[model samples]
Target: MSGVEFNRRLESIPVYPAAESYGEDEGLIKLASNETPWGPPPAVIGAIQGQLETLNRYPDPAKSVLRRRIAERSDVPISKVVVGNGSCEILLAAGDALLEPGAEIVYAWPSFSMYPHLAAQSGARAVEVPLANGVHDLEAMAREVNAATRLVLVCNPNNPTATAVGIDEIDAFVASLPRHVAVILDEAYVEFNLLQDPGESIDLLSKHSNLVVLRTFSKVYGLCGLRAGYALGTEEFRLAVDRVRQP
Candidate 1:
């Protein structure tokens, strides 16, 4: 044994429960990871294949082209966009950039497993409010916010349960929080949301500078292997998180 010491804070963080694998099982349908039933479009496959010849070179560190496309689609400025390996990376970066010891991070319990892990990894206190009727209890979450609170993560169309909070409710929730607290709206499965309009959440960014919305191409777009995702927020927020991102 190397007798190497890991970060002691890891002792308090629970292991993320990844979905069990059924290796090489034919004709089996797996829904645990929220992957798309179909493969990516032919054009997407062609684009990726077309780039294979340039594999010797590193990708654009700024990801300017993709960021510009995403910005145009989201109707946000390109400076406001920060791309990541995946939305999960964006989440982790947000925690690293915003969370610290004595700071508190709030999110709905029984929601995404990453929230608790992110809090522990950052040495921040986690305030996990129990979900109400399989959905995020926004009011309870807002009440948990105190002066110590630095980050709030709302997983709309929340994992495991697939229920989403409405846009009006989100607007009210943001309006209730203090400006110092940054809110992360993780819309990882938003494309699958049929109950309410998914685009409405992006509109909140204009009204709340402290709010950021995260999206990924992994779910509906079937690009899980590509690990493409991004966050839309103010230029200041993007810069903060970008500083913590890997080159």
Candidate 2:
């Protein structure tokens, strides 16, 4: 081991529980991870194959083409879109950019495990509000937000539990929060749980300045191997997160 000291915050972080593997002879089926078992659609395959000719060239650092498409799809301005290797990268970027020593981030307990891990890496406190009956207790979470709280993560259709909070509930929660705090709506599974209207988050962005909605192509779009995802928010939030992202 190196002589350099490690960050104290890492002490509480558990090793990430990765999917288990099996030997060829064992032939064990792997189902622990949340992944699409099927192959990518023909269009996605075609688009990827189309990029093979330019494999030697580096992609546009700005990712303008993909960002433009995500902007249009999310109904957000191009300036407010920031793409990433995956939504997880966007989440990690938020932690790096928004949190500071002694800062706190609030999110539902038993939700995505990464929320707390990201907060810890930033030397921030992970304020976990226990879920009420397998759903986010948004009211409790809002109450936990004090001056030290810098960020909140809401995983709609929360992971592990497979429950979601609706648009109306989200609207009230944002309105109740202090304007200084930023909230990230991790809609990694939104496509599977859309309501009567699918653009609610996009529409809500116009009203909530501190909100960031993250989406990933790994889910319904079936592009897990491509590692594409994006975040849509106000120009201020997007730019701040982008500054921490790897170019």
Candidate 3:
């Protein structure tokens, strides 16, 4: 698939200028991107500096430090977390593992572009559900699910729109889905959720075995460049995603 054509979609995406390129003297308040100007804390920087001598050595493939921390914080088991290059890598890994030609991937439109990109890259059909006032309508999304549906994607506290579907509502949606279908919760922006406790999703995972919760170091940790994120779920599901990930 290396030689696969990208077609016109990639061409259509607008090329916005980087905020970093803005002149130092401009004093621009750039909200066009939500990146945190202040990144890792002083202690984190000091720790990284201490590890600079070992930078030449291969980093942990399992990402033990990050994974254990996330597991302790998330309340999901360690076996459930599968860390990858970034949130995109985890989603793309989901694509590589599950998507096949003619298979279906249902996602909310205008939520995240990567959902469609991964769907296309896997040569699968992409079903984009329209948002209702910037929130995902789980009922409408459920209507699109069929036997051929390989994955149903939900980007909560949705990107570009930044709205959340509450825990009760999200749980109801997961319960409503058929057991055969997999539901991926894309909670990339979840850390900064102001309306409710972010840990609610972790609790929901126990009910729906097919649910895969996605998280990232990019958004809250402010480590998007570090290319680290993880997916948490049952052992079977993590292994299901791992087969596509392992070289």
The C-alpha lDDT values of all candidates are: 0.90, 0.86, 0.83
The C-alpha TM-scores of every prediction are 0.94, 0.94, 0.87
Task: Estimate the Cα RMSD of every predicted model relative to the unseen true structure.
Answer: 1.8, 1.7, 3.5
Least accurate stretch of 10 residues (summed lDDT) in model 2? 17-26
Residue 170 of model 1 has an lDDT of 88
Q: Write the per-residue lDDT of candidate 3 for residues 93-115, one digit (tens) a residue.
A: 88888888889989998888678
Taking the tens digit of each residue's C-alpha lDDT, what string does model 1 give over 1-247? 7999999999988765444454666676766677777889999999999999999999999999999999999998999999999999989999999999999999997988778888889899999899998989999999999999999999998987889888888899999999999999999998878766777998889999999999999988899989999999999988988899886
TM-score quality measure for candidate 3: 0.87
Candidate of highest lDDT: 1
> Higher TM-score: candidate 2 or 3?
2
lDDT comparison, 1 vs 3, better candidate: 1
Name the regions of candidate 2 deviating beyond 4 angstroms.
1-4, 20-26, 194-196
- Model 1: residues with Cα > 4 Å off, grouped in runs: 16-29
